[model samples]
Target: MTKMIFLNLPVKDLATATAFYEAIGCVKNEQFSNENASSMVWSETITFQLLQHGYYQTFTTKPTADAHATSGMLIALSRDSREEVDAMVEAAARSGGQADVREPQDLGFMYLRSFADPDGHDFEPAYMDMGSVG
Candidate 1:
């Protein structure tokens, strides 16, 4: 069975990145955090590894993608409501990040907004009304 999920990101400044994630409401799990990396917890089953650029290189030979220059992937999170989605995006902006990477979108049952962290990692916070789907 899939026990847990860890999303690892290469960051330029560990301290700055750690603070950015924390500012957006993630909890840091000290047991898996250190100077080189931080384990930011989103939920009991989901954790994000914010690794220093050099430390991240130890795991791969390919050049790390410059998050600011390009989009390799998009990190998406679910919010409880449309207002929560907007609030998160606002928080990211207040925390020295870029908010509204794209125009906010609203479908009949879904609301979404994108933001970029200080390190240029992109994230999408979304709200979906399950009652509208099967």
Candidate 2:
């Protein structure tokens, strides 16, 4: 059984991608970080690998998908509170990410904000108060 989860993502600029995620509270795993790649740990279960352009090609034969214009993948993170969700989305924007086409919304029991990373990767930070979700 696998013990750790790795999310491999391709980025145009490793340094910029690393900095963007760092600004949003992710810490780099220096042991696994190098010039062409950086391992940004989100939690014990989640680690996002930011690889330089074309690097991922070495590991997979599949062609890369357009994260912005087409449906490929969406990364989601759960925040502890609405404020935290807002902070993460805002941090992404401040670090070169763009705000989602739809604005943040509150749904009585939950709140969510979506953003696109520098690579045009879609991500969402959402908060669901206990008892509010069924």
Winner by lDDT = 1
- Count of clashes in candidate 2: 0
Candidate 2 Cα deviation (angstroms), residue 72:
1.0
Clashing pairs in 2: none
- The regions of model 1 sitting more than 4 angstroms off are none
lDDT tens digits, residue span 1-134, model 2: 65888999989889899999998889999999888899999998889999987887788888877676775877889999988998998899899998764677899898988998898888988899989678
RMSD of each: 1.3, 1.6
For model 2 the local lDDT of residue 38 reads 98
Show where candidate 2 strays beyond 4 Å: none
